[model samples]
Target: MNSLTHSSTSVVRKASRFLLTSRRFCDTSRINGDEETLKITWETSEMDCGFAEEHEKISVRRTFLESTKLSASQVLDTLKQDCPGFNTKLALDELNVPISGLLVREVLLGILRRLSFDNKTRCAKLAYKFFVWCGGQESFRHTANCYHLLMKIFAECGEYKAMCRLVDEMIKDGYPTTARTFNLLICTCGEAGLAREVVEQFIKSKTFNYRPFKHSYNAILHSLLGVKHYKLIEWVYEQMLEDGFSPDLLSYNVVMFASFRLGKTDKLYRLLDEMVKDGFSPDLHTYNILLHHLATGNKPLAALNLLNHMREVGVEPSVIHFTTLIDGLSRAGKLEACKYFMDEMVKAGCTPDVVCYTVVITGYISGGELEKAEEMFREMTVKGQLPNVFTYNSMIRGFCMAGKFKEARLLLKEMESRGCNPNFVVYSTLVNNLRNAGKLLEAHEVVKDMVEKGHYVHLISKFKKYTRS
Candidate 1:
């Protein structure tokens, strides 16, 4: 029979049993005997279980799953006392219910409690397992907690993309999330391939009553620059302005760098003017980015102008800023200007690091000035900055280019003795230099060595097309 028919039958049987049970305790008394029989029957018929109440009880049990009485602290303490470096999965299985709520605070505090490991990444992995349990249960509240915790773990561990996914899930679940949550989501999106989702989701969330925070706007702005979405970046800037939030230095930097990438150096300068007009004091990074554009771009004059402007504005140039300027001048074939930056770099009380020496050494090598390059290399060693592969490679290439093959071969041997294996460029240089010196057999031997050492060696290849016959 169908369920409804079976249920009706059961109800009839229950009503009959209630009538049979009540008849023993009741009597058809002297007065109104027929009416009393009717009244007793009606009372017995009315004695029924309320189906709505039973259904509601069943629903409450099914939906909430008997929420655990265990606090997170209690769970953690029990796990620590029992497992003590053992995975919590084994311990969780032994528990009747799971922990949930305020995931960020719990996870951050939990990790801090287990700060014994040197690496500390294992703690995050454990956190991952805990959250996976929460997700599997499909408990929105608990799942939200897990997502929140995962965001923190991903943020601290620099797994930006994973954090973004968690935020997306939280949004989809219709949780009343915070601006900080969305900001982190945007940042994580910035680092990953699916960065555009951050912006789209943020805009969509406006219907849910969230206005863009500074971090939200900044995240989208920064991410746009990452993917070179120039058009959208401008659109976002306009949107931010309309939202009543002024774009800050960070926004300007992204726009400037994006302009630089698009070969719009003039536009980048114009943007810089906008930045100044907005009363945003250009920070060190702003100057650094501009210096990078000037130094790396085909505009040494613009770079020099920026350097002068920086000095006038009292923004002291660090070793890195000077390095970029020096390297840029060298790349532009302005050796004297390069040396001038180096001198000023030292005079400004920023001591040159190995990077500075390497730049100048590379410049000399590119100019085919072997003697000056070697002099700089030796000077770096004398100043107690140990020579790295870059230092050795620069000197070796300089020797090879100057047609000093004998010195190049000796340097190669010295490199090997010092545990520095010659890379592709070094091998190619040796082979080509030997071939040009009329030592074809030696060239072949070097090619064989490169193959055995797993270095790429195309005998007919050119390191520079100018070197080939």
Candidate 2:
């Protein structure tokens, strides 16, 4: 065998040994601690998904409150009406209302939500003034949610310094800094394209005395992965090892993902070997990472072999495992192979979900196989898998790519008929493709529809720029 094959074989053997021996090294105390940390990790991840949803729900729930003597909406309106421009503090100081001790958590949150809706820094300042005013009240103390909300505003408005100050204040005030807070700071900063700053904050956590969780390094690394900061993740992993923190299964999976993302294949294998030697076994996430790397690296056979090995180790391959492989294959332009694996997924008793179908459809579309894309789209529907906004967007984009404007429009109508309302992407795809095809009138219609449907009304001005004489 070639050196690469030999090396791979050796890693596989070590992995096998690692998997078989991992149970023997399970320390009860450590396992309990790790489980609790893992629970926090899972909650943080769940919160990330539900963050926007929960925000919307909160806003909606308080939209029409019962007419109390002084309602939240009335207070918010008073603030907006009186606090014109940036003179929020001045306006609040002059207001002859007993605002202190009257505002509950819900009221405070509602007011903050209203202020944050515009997502302007000026608005954040107004929100912060109100927040400070409330804090100064003898009868009122900000809840953890209140601090998180205000911090979110600051982070969203790029007021990192203000956000950090708030974090320091939270710690100083002896509020329990939970995993949610840690995730919020990292994710919001990362989303704002300040991933490096997240890493910097994590590195400076000791300096700031900002250790939220016992597994702070792992939490930071995991949060960084969510934001796709592969290089930062690897750097943090290095820092973790330097700080004498042993790599857990999650840490290994995270660093392995980083290595895969960075294209450090050799280093990835070496890390696997090291993990095995360290008595860590490959979990489902580990297998998924390896599957993604192997398949996307155009080594489908090796990926399949790995899948077999996974089964041999009594690890059931989930739909996610199959989807990861299919996605990687699709990325590698192996559409046929993707289909083969899709079949294999079903044969292995895992039914393909909309995401799985979407990946394959997207693959066919990207490869310019529009007919195959259409076939798969139909097949998914026949299999009772309704195309989501993403699937519809993919098909619509495919249709537009082939200059089939009529078909794309029909698909848009079909999306609405099927209760899949076209989102910003679907509308933008149509407008852009129609405009590019010189169907200016059609593009204008799509934009008008988009505005009427309450999506990107501001895009009208931008669209006009391109359409102008």
> Which one wins on TM-score?
2
Q: Candidate 1: deviation at residue 368, Å?
A: 3.3
lDDT of 2 at 45: 90
User: Judged by lDDT, which candidate is best?
Assistant: 2
Off by over 4 Å in 2: 1-15, 20-70, 81-119, 191-194, 202-214, 461-469
Model 2, span 1-469: residue lDDT tens:
3755654565456557656545565465766777989988999999987998998888875753333335545556656664447565555556534543335444556654554335466667666777887787665678878888778777667787787688778878877665567677777766667767756665666532235435778777777787688988888888888989998888888898899999998898888888888888788888888888878887777777777788899998999999999999999999989989999999999999999999999999999999999999999999999999999999999999999999999999999998888877888888888988899888887776777778765555656454422
- Checking candidate 2 for backbone clashes, the offending pairs are none
Worst lDDT 10-window in candidate 2: 96-105
lDDT of 1 at 399: 80
- Candidate 2 global lDDT: 0.78
- Compose the digit string of candidate 1's lDDT tens values, residues 1-469: 3654454343233222211355454454654968878988887666544666678899986654433323455555644543457656666656645445653246446765564435346656556666665556545355444556567666666666567566666767676566556555655556564556666676556322334535567766765665567766777777877888877778888877777767786777678777777777777777777667666654555565566666766777799998988887788777777878888888889888888898899999998777788888888878887666777778877887777877877887787887877777777767777777777776776666666666653433553332222
Give all candidates' CA lDDT scores: 0.66, 0.78
